[model samples]
Target chain A: MIQIKEVVKTYPARDGGSVVTALDGVTLTINRGDIFGIVGYSGAGKSTLLRLINGLEMPTKGEVIVDGKEISRLKERELRQARQKIGMIFQHFHLLWSRTVRENVAFPLEVAGLPKEQIRKRVDQLLERVGLAERADAYPSQLSGGQKQRVGIARALANEPDILLCDEATSALDPETTASILQLLKEIHREMGITLVLITHEMSVVRQICNKMAVMENGRVVETGMVSSIFSQPQQALTKQFVKELQPSTQGDDTSGEVVELPLGDADKLVALAKEHGIRFSVVSGAIAGEQDDCLRVRVDGTEAQMQAVRQVLCGGERAC
Target chain B: MLTGIDWNQVSVALGETLYMVSISTLFTALLGIPLGVMLTVSDRGYFWENMWVQRTLGTIVNIFRAVPFIVLVLFLFPVAEFLVGTTLGPTAATVPLIAGAAPFYARMVETALREIDRGVIEAAQAMGASRLNIIWKVLLPEAMPAIVSGLTVTCVSLISFSAMAGIVGGGGLGDAAFRYGFQSFNDGMLYICGLLLVVMVQLIQMVGDWLVRRLDKR
Candidate 1:
């Protein structure tokens, strides 16, 4: 569990210029067992928010509470102890090039002062879990980007932390690698039940695995809600833009037409009935509306008389038209 | 050409050169590594992040490095006399040798440490590693190859500094060349000493490069 309360972070300019505000009066709560995704473009304060969760950067004016402890006020020594329970993975993977995979994974365990025997056992298990057991002896330079991220994941999970913060964890990979990494993250959340707070500019990443989501712009949270609701009914302009980008494109054609929503099972029936009546119809988009709720959305194009006939069947032949 | 060269004296001089280089290099590494690590960590945004310490140490290293080695040896004559109880032999020469070379080597160490990726250090910190752990486990190991190369360069300089110590009656091949080759006009002895110094430098460089290549995993 994490709570960010009215947090404001400012950094003095390097050239003795005016201060820059990275986060302004931001509040967010990530519940336990949540794969919470924070989506925003660069400079949207997404990374600053993730860093505050683990006390990597202190807020200038507000409190960051994680697991009920105020991270903003903790001393350096106390923060070090607290950080062991909050693992972070980076877009660059941030692995120590001098160390092999096994040693890299054992790093957190060594920092936690685990015994040598215990560390060895734990690292082996972690390597196996991330499917990097065979490459345990390889340096980061020898592995591909995907393998390097697997090592990062193993190293992050070494301490068995209660939360994992991913700062664009898959942003550096190709699309295929990104999908595989995202699937691995989903598996990690399902099996470990660890809370995940991921920040990325990619809306598709959030839609793939995140259960809850937030949209950020210019150092503030513009929108936040369940992923399903935000996808179906985006409230803000930026949120709508993100949701629209995910829609099946109309091939650069004008989208002005009659939009209809029906259950997934009834989609084929409507298409057949429209075909029999000589009405032009096309399926616009389809998505899982909610948990166990599948819906099909389509766009129908025809004359006013033709539209009336389609609505008549749905209105029970009343011809209220 | 070899007739005028005294083989016994040349051997003794060669031994003295080795003695001076080995002792000074040991002390230089011992002093320089910690100074370099301190200079690196005390820098702004590093683990220690102390502006005063970084600036002060940096200034001292620069001051020592800026002085010419011959002049540094002359200036440290009193120190050598006080520490080694004499200013006339290979042992006494090391006092100034380390003083000159440690700061030179420290600067190299700083550069090597600076080359490390900042993200690696941040990763270590995020894992809750203590400051000591970060320095020992992350910074030092990551910069090892460059550090070794730096030491090699420092050791070669130390060999040349030992030759300069001969100007002050600090005994070595340089003293032998000065006494027999320049003063007594024995050109053969001068060539032999010069040739031997070149050989020593080449050997040190070869070893240094090999070690760096071996240590560099990236």
Candidate 2:
């Protein structure tokens, strides 16, 4: 488990003016055995927050507690000892090109000053776990990108770390590779019972594996909730922007040029208009994208009562009809 | 024509040259790598210091690198004498050779280290590695090829500098040439010593190139 309390990090500019604040009063807690997702755009200080948890960068203010120890205040030796409990993976793979995959995976154990034979056994077990046992002898340059990331995964897990922090772990990967890596991360989380914390701008990555989620903007947590709940009902504007992009329905404006009558409170208008003229509506994506009286047209005439029931069940605001 | 030259003296000069060059190269490398790491660590823009220390170091290294090796030999005779109690033998002569060669090699090492990706450093740290671990494992191993190439350059440069050790009776191949070939203007001796110097330089270059290639091969 990790606890962050009011952490702030600022770096002075070379021009000697106002400083750049990377993290400002960020407080969050990550429980054990949970894949916590932190989503934000570029420059949202997501990477900085992740670095603080791993003890790679100390916070300028407050404390970061990991495994019940205050990591932010730890000395070099103590911090290193504490960091052995935390593993991390990066988007760039970070495999040592000069070393074989086995050596890369073995580096952390070697750095821990473990016995050489133990390191060898651990690396073999890790490489086998990541399904890269056959590629153990191969150098990073000799392997494909996905295989290289597999090696990185094996290396991160070699220490048997209690927590794994992934910083944009799949952003550099292709879609299928990203999917496999995400699945592998999920499996690793479940199988090892390690706490997983990943930060990314990709909503799809969150959709696949995250249980608890936090959306960050301008170095602040704007919204936090469950994955399915956030997908079905997002609170913040940024959350809506991300969730709408994931929706299967909702194309371009349906009623801007082509109108639809969902046969609701517009029943009288539909009859009066039907007497004068017949209106033909085409269905696309089983939902429409249009607005009347500040109410967005979410569905059309396919299911009339369900729309009202959805509206009645979800009475959001005064804008809802 | 060179058949008349003293073969015994030539062999001695060749041996002494080998002694002087290798010793100086080894000494400078020992002194240089630490200095190079310090230079990178203490670089003003990278570290917290002002530009004065960096500028001062740059000035000193450049001053040494810019001075001709023969002048350096003459310049450091007093310091060499103070350090070695006598400046006449190969051991004494090696003082200035190392002094002159270290900054050059240190600069090369600094360049090699500076070229390593900072991302590798961050990744190493993220793995719970200490700064020393990153330096030994990530920085040194990743920069090995460049460091090998730098050593090659330093070896060849030190070999070239060995010719200037003839001053103060330093007694390498340059002494043989000065005593018999260049100063006395013995065409036969001159041709043999000159030919020998050329051969020596060529051999140094070949070994250096081979070592670099061998070490650089992944």
Candidate 3:
């Protein structure tokens, strides 16, 4: 559904000078109906890649092809028309604060100049799909972060887009919310056969929904393959760095004596592996099994919204005021 | 009570004041907003990138913006007279009001329009909204509250400028007070006019604040 070939983008420095290259010859193809994932840390050109797919930022060089159309060559009029078929959600959710949930969802439809009845029908379908039917009348400021993302999800789906591009879509959500959203995307993809693309620093994002994964570092795709392959045996060092969590220590490793610094990415995998091996793995050093260990070292899930809820609950809801 | 203070005359003068200020405010908003949107569309990187177009439009806007209202009134008398077929009446006076302050109002509107989140613009563009639809549906709607507030501010500014119109022989409350208060030495009438202007400002401010809040309920 989406094709990017040798795309390059450069932004000039703040002080009249040389340019900073954001994307350096990124060649990627996301098959239709695939939940494709691009994983990277900050400044890995993930966002730049996302914008190119949506045709928001034209490639400084090369071509971005969506469906049969070359989006980079499409004019503004054609681009907006093209974008209607490709829905996107942001990390921040990007809900218009002035508008209520329903209105925010209605914006794209309104922009597309869709008829009122069709727009309403689509919006209702989307809101129901995102499980935000109850909060349609509420403003974004009144909704929780997860709820806002849900609304954004509904909005993104309003156009019945053939491609859904989520740029850290779940990053601002809690774990529970992220899982729900991931499940929602999976459901939508399953039912409608629409292609979904998500980029994040969180590994679980790929684990849960993405069937295809690409590992990016320094604006280049180091590895791209099936999700199970990348998780089981990552070829690139960076990919391995991301997938280290699922690996088990060789059968005779001495974890019974004391806590050891295991090279695991997330706590869930650590626990699962330890239980599977029937070994007593103590996390005593660094952030191995402490409070911080609970967080994904890779942040592939990109759902950052849980931290606030955790804080609110831990602080007895008083700090939320 | 001052011996010669005519309360009835004060009321009529207030009526005239209301008439003059209302007309000027209407013209400013009517003419200014479209001008501002034009400025936004005409600039480089948007539409028609001709440097001469940008320069000519910028110079026209700046010429009006930089001139004082008092000078613009005097400068525009011929044009105002030609437009309205009268050089010295409330109706004729509006031409100068729109000409003198429309650019300033447009500039304020342009700033307000620009302050809208660029994300909204991108989102609109991504959705296949035409340039006109982007303006009418997204940019204009998003900037509505600010534009309304800007209009209120422009109204208040127009009320102040109306006082300068009195110099062009368009007799309104300002002229009444100037003749009856400053020149005729009617201090009580001057005070009354000052108080009325204050009340008018408060009314405009109250309505403006309420409108901005209503439009941006969040």
**Top candidate when judged by TM-score against the true structure:** 1
Cα lDDT tens digits for candidate 3, A1-321: 788999888886766877888889999998887889999999999988988987877788889999989997887667777888998887887667777888889988887778999888888888888888888888998988888888877888877889998889888788998998888888888888888989999998888888778988888888997675466446788888787643445334322232222234435654554454443443332222222232221211112343232223232221111
Who wins the DockQ comparison? 1
- Scored by lDDT, model 2 comes in at 0.77
Ranking by TM-score: 1, 2, 3
Q: What is the DockQ of candidate 3?
A: 0.38
Q: Write candidate 1's Cα lDDT for B1-218 as tens digits.
A: 65699999999999999999999999999999999999999998898999999999999999998998888988998899999899788888999999999999998999999999898888899999999999899999999999889989989988888888966877888888889888988999989998999999999999999999888889
- Which 10-residue window in model 1 chain A sums to the lowest lDDT? A312-321
Deviation of model 3 at A153, angstroms: 1.4
Regions of candidate 3 where Cα sits further than 4 Å from its true position: A12-15, A244-321, B40-56
Report the alpha-carbon TM-score of model 2 versus the true structure.
Answer: 0.83
- Model 3 agreement with the true structure over B24-130: per-residue lDDT tens digits: 78878888888778777667555323667667777899998898888888888888767888888677667788887788888888888778766666665666667
Output the lDDT of residue B120, model 1: 85
Considering summed lDDT, which 10 consecutive residues are worst modelled in model 2 chain A? Answer: A285-294
User: At residue B71, what lDDT does model 2 achieve?
Assistant: 81
TM-score of chain B of each: 0.97, 0.87, 0.91
Name the candidate, 1 or 3, with the larger lDDT value: 1
lDDT score, candidate 2, position A84: 77
TM-score of every prediction relative to native: 0.88, 0.83, 0.81
Superposed Cα deviation of residue B116, candidate 2 (Å): 1.4
The Cα local distance difference test for each model comes to 0.88, 0.77, 0.75
Per-residue lDDT of model 2, residues B117-183, tens digit only:
6666677887778767877887678777777778777877776677767645678787787788877
TM-score of chain B of 3: 0.91
